[model samples]
Target: MFDLVIRNGLLIEADGVTKADLAIDGEQIAAVGLSLQGRREIDATDCYVLPGAIDPHVHLQMPLAGMVSTDDFRTGTIAAACGGVTTIIDFVEPKPGQSMLEALALRQEEAKNKVAIDYGLHMTIPTWHANAADGLKEVPAVVEAGCLSFKMYQAYEGMMLDDVALLRALTAVGEAGGRTVLHSETGPVLDYLRAEALAEGHVEPIWHAYTRPAPLEASAVHRAAELADLASCPLYIFHVGCQESVEAILQARSRRIDIWGETCPQYLLLNAEEHLGGPNGALYVCAPPLRSVEDNRAMWHALAQDALQVVSTDHCPWTFEEKQQPDFTRIPGGVPSIEARLSLVHHFGVNQGLLTLERWVEVCSTNAARWMGLTRKGRLAPGYDADIVIFDPARIKKITPATLHEAAGWTPYDGMEVCGWPRTVLLRGKVIVEDEQYVGAPGDGRFIPRRPSALS
Candidate 1:
């Protein structure tokens, strides 16, 4: 007999939707057929059963431009579970004097008892340091150790890689069986813009995005794509927002470059116009600051064209207290998103006809898993991990911090109405969230490694 059975639920994925009785044995899926018997049966009469979300780009806990994000692995992963995500791939920072392996080990130890679902780490190569060089050398072992990918910054003063090192790291990951991910932006140009903006007395909260214009992001996107092409490396651009950036990605993709781009719920749901509105204006501030509605429309079109491959939260949450502490030049650059990415996408995209249900599965779950190399993290089938969300298709819910599971205590998505919500979440066949509450322990989360692909 199967251990658990999810009955009468519609299985939605990249392929299509079908009615099935999905059975689970221990942690893996046991079967998907009619009349499956199990120790427990959940009647998912009108629910949608999709693979749990795999959030590939997130900063669960880490230093940012100045302050740290509000969510730790424990709180962030629980919020993720409440949102129906089962797997997360977050970054691990390098210690000033530690080897990449040393830093990675330390990070794993820290996360060992701090997560509520499966997790993995992406090594962020801070800059062109000797340790970065040494770290790149062990990437093969890192990949073998289940870390599997490297990340680079192009904006933070001390963290962004120089042009030569960026190209070199891309090439090294290409050769070392790992993927190279980029946070694209022109640091120097942005710095110049911010100085000019602030020197001329343009320091209002709304001026943040204005200081770093879309052209800067677009130029960096082109340059990064060129570098990735030069190295013959696989590229993944994190948190893509502007039209020009997406266009650059599309143009490169047309030439058959193995490059993937990601856009977040913020870009899809909020635009530059909101940043300039009201007394609560400071709430919308984030790096790659939200762009115009036209940019948002263009990004939506990009998704419809399959030019944008993934949708993620870029799930970094920060307090207004800490984020607002920076002067115009140093204000932290992120938004609160751990609990809102999926529902916002569903409310706006799926309901408005911008995304078909299949595409929703692709953008929110499947593609993220495929890109991050989490093999068993983003599907529903026999032998796949029983990480699933039982979604109520017609349930109407408002997004507010009052209902969040993240330690951040608040959400920027307050007051937004959604027609569907995840009412149940399972991680490796264990119920983590049921009826909108977390039921799992923190240490239950495990580390995930990418399966061999271009990273091989």
Candidate 2:
């Protein structure tokens, strides 16, 4: 007999769905077929059994502008477990003069006994020096350390990389057999616009979107794609937000470039004008700020057509009071949706008939695992880790800060009604969440060592 069995559930995978019983042995899936038996069984009648979602972009306990994101590894991974995300990949940012390897070790120490679910890390190259053999020279060693992906920014002050430096970094990572993830936005353009806006006394939250418009993002995407093509690197763009950017990705793919794109739930459902202009507007102050309603429609279409491959939560957040700044520039920018990503995407994407159930599984789980090299974590098949979610499509939930496990004390999706909440979640064959409450403790999670991207 197996260790556990989930019987009579509609098993969903990236390519299809079927009604079957899933058996778990030890910490991996043992079988998936009719009449599976186990020593312990969970009745999953009228539910969808899926590979737990994998969010490849999140910023728990990240430091920025003299403050830290409210959710650390423990709280954030607990919130992620409650949302059906069984695996997450967060970034490692090195401080001034710190080697990428050293920073990674420190970051791992911080999460050592804290995470509630399996996790991975992506090295962030805030700055690089070729002559001094700074960050670029360590690419091979870092990749060998199991961080097979690296992140580069095109917009932040201390984090942005120039074109030459970006090309060098991309080449190094590509040669080391890893993928490059980019936060693509034109830094110079954003700086000029923000300066102009502040000079004109337009410090309202709305100016945040006004200063970083769609075209700026599109241009930066095009540039990044071109550089990736030149370096022969597999590229993944994060938080893509507009039609222009999608068109750029399409053009790049048309040239047979190996590239992928990701979008967040906020960009697909919340619009700029609606969420960025009021007494509570500070809550929506994230980078590459929200777009128009038309842009939202475009985002859905892109996902349906496979122009975008993943929907991750940038999952960085501060308390409500911490967001109260005198100007948009001073406001801590991020949205907390670690506990709401799955339900939001299901309600809006599947319930609305915009995304097929198969596509939903692809974007929410499988694709992220494939692209990020978490081979055993994202599929519901024999030999894969038994990280699963039993989703009750009939259950309805009205979102509120109190219902969430995030420490941020607020949510961008407050009062939004959604269905298909996770009735049960399993992390590595262990039940971690049941009936929408987290039953798992901190340190239940193990660090995952990843391989090079499947694209590589």
Candidate 3:
């Protein structure tokens, strides 16, 4: 007999959904067929059994602007588990003059015994110089250590890379069989606009969105795509927020460039004008701030059309008091959504007819795995890790900070009604969440070593 079995559930995969029984032996799915039995069984009648979602981006306890985000590895992954995420990919930002491998080791130390679910790391190229032989030479070793991906920024002051350096770094990573993930925003333009706004006495939260308008993001995406093409590198764009950026991805893919795009729930559901103007507006402050209603519509359409391959939560969070700043620039920029992504997407994307069930699974789980090289973590087939989520379609609730596991004191989606919450979650055949309450322990999670990107 198998170790455990989930019976009479509708199994949802990226390709299709069907009624089946899933059996697990040890930590892997043993079979998916009719009449499967196990020594221990869970009744899943009327539930949707899906592969646990994989959040490809998050920043737990990330330091920014002299303050660290509220959720650390332990709290953050617990929240993720409650929301049905079985794996997450977080970044490693090396200190100034630090080697990439050194930063990776330090980051692993921080999360070693704290994570509540499996996780992988992506090395961030803080700054790249053509003459910097030592830094570039570590790409292959880092990849060999199982990172398999690198992050490059085009917009931060100290972290941004110039075109030449970016191209060179992309080429180095490509030659090492790894993919390059980019944060596409034009730094100089943003600085100029923010200075103009602040000089004009426009210090409200709305100015944050006004200063970093959609065109800057689109232009940066276009530039990054061109550089990736020149380097023959596989590229993944993070937090794509507008239609112009979506069009840029479409154009690049039309030419057979190996490129992928991701959008977050904020860009898909919240609009700038409505969510960024009140006294509490600072709470929604985040980089590449929310976009217009038309942009939200465009984001949904792009996901449905497969122009965007992943929908991840850039799950960085700050406390409410920490966000209360006199100037918009002083406000820490990030919002918490690690525990809300799946339900929000299921309510707004699937229940509202914007995304099919299969498409939802693809964007929320399968595609992220395929692109990020988490080969065994994102599927429920035999021999794959038995990470699963059982969602109750009829469950409904209004969101409130009190009901969430994020250490942040508030949420951007407060009071929004949503359906289809995860009632059970399994990580490697171990039940970690039952009835939406996390039963997992700290240090139960292990580091996931990734393979080269499947897209590569």
Candidate 4:
């Protein structure tokens, strides 16, 4: 006998969708086909049973820039569960005088007994540490510790890596069979632009976007891709928001490089203009600050053409109260989207005819799982984990914090109309979300260990 059975739902596997019944035994799929019996049964007529989304970019309770995000693992993962995400891979920023593995362990303790869903972490190697020089040595230890990916930043010069150090980290990924993800803004150029903007009294939130405009990003992308190619490393550029960045990725691909890019909903939906005309638009603030409307359209085109491989939330949550804390620079730097990611993508991309339903699942779920190296986590196939989402393609709803599960208590996607919503979310055969509410327990999340990439 199975533990749970989902009946009469159209299953969306990697290839396509088809009618099927899924059976679960403990934490894995026991059977899939027709009329399977289990202790519990879900009637899923007219709904799509898809693999639970694996969001590879999320910052829950992450301390950054001086303030910590308001969403802890409990709230963040609950929000993720309600939105049909099965697994979340967050970052572990190493503190001064800490080992990278020790840093990950501390983060795991912080998340333990608090998360409502499964989670994994990427180690952010700060440049100014002896540990960074020790990066090649620590790669194997962390990979063996279930943390397989490492992130390097270019713009946070004092904190992130230098290009030489960046190259060393990339070569290390090749050595460890691990993957590398980067925040590709060029720090020196950004510092120059910021200095220029400040000297000109461009303190407005919109000016933030203008300050770190496309050329800096374009130059950074071109350089970062070249470095990755030189190391023959599989590099992923995170939250790309401009045309030149896309062009850089395409340029690298043309030269037979295996580099990838991920764009957020904000870049594909909102633009830099949202941050215009003083502090009124400050609520829309985020780093790499939102780009032009033309950039938005370009991002959509990239998604449609497969130039970008994943569409993730970058789901960093914060409250309006927290954001109102005087200096815009002092306030938090991220907006919440875990609860709205899948629906927003479906509404704008699929419902508006920009993306096919299959492509919606691909961008939001499958590709994210694959990119994050969670091979068995992104599809509703026979052998994969029963991480599933039952979504009503026609359910209409407005984005609002009234339905949010995060402690941040706000949504940047607020007040927008959307035409889809997740009905139930199952992670490892356990239904963590039901009827748009979270029912999972804290401590339920497990650290995800990734396999070394085959290409490496």
**For residues 1-456, what per-residue lDDT tens digits would candidate 2 score against the true structure?**
899999999999998999999999999999999998899999999999999999999999998878999999999999999999999999999887888889999999999999999999999988644324655888899999999999999988888898988998899999999889999999988999999999999989999999998998999999999999999899999998899999999999999998899999999999889999866888999988999999999999999999999999999999999999999989998999998999899999999999988899999999999999997988999999999999999899999998888999999999999987999999999999988788998998987988974543
lDDT of 3 by residue, 261-372 (tens): 9999999988778988876889888888998999999999999999999999999899999999999988998899999999999999999999999999999999999999
lDDT of 2: 0.92
Lowest lDDT sum, 10 consecutive residues, model 4, at: 127-136
lDDT per residue as tens, model 4, 229-310: 8887788999998999999999989998888899998888887776544445666777778888999989988998889988
RMSD of 4: 1.9
Q: Cα deviation of 196 in candidate 1 (Å)?
A: 1.3
Rate residue 37 of model 3 by lDDT. Answer: 78
lDDT of 1 by residue, 1-456 (tens): 889999999999888898888999999998988989989988899999999988888887786655567888888888888998888888878867657788888888878988998988898777744235364676677778888778888887778876787888888887876887888999988888888988888777777777878888888888888888888888999888998898888888888788999898888778766764545556677778888899888777777778898888887777766655445455566677767677777878888999899888889988888878877767788888899999987989988788777666567678888999898999999999888888999998998777666221
In model 2, what is the error at residue 149, expressed in angstroms?
0.7
Q: Candidate 2: where are CA atoms >4 Å away?
A: 128-132, 453-456
Total backbone clashes of candidate 2, pairs 3 or more residues apart or in separate chains: 0
| True lDDT of residue 383, candidate 2 | 97
State the TM-score for model 2: 0.98
Segments in model 3 whose C-alpha atoms lie over 4 Å from true places: 128-131, 453-456
Better of 1 and 3 by lDDT: 3
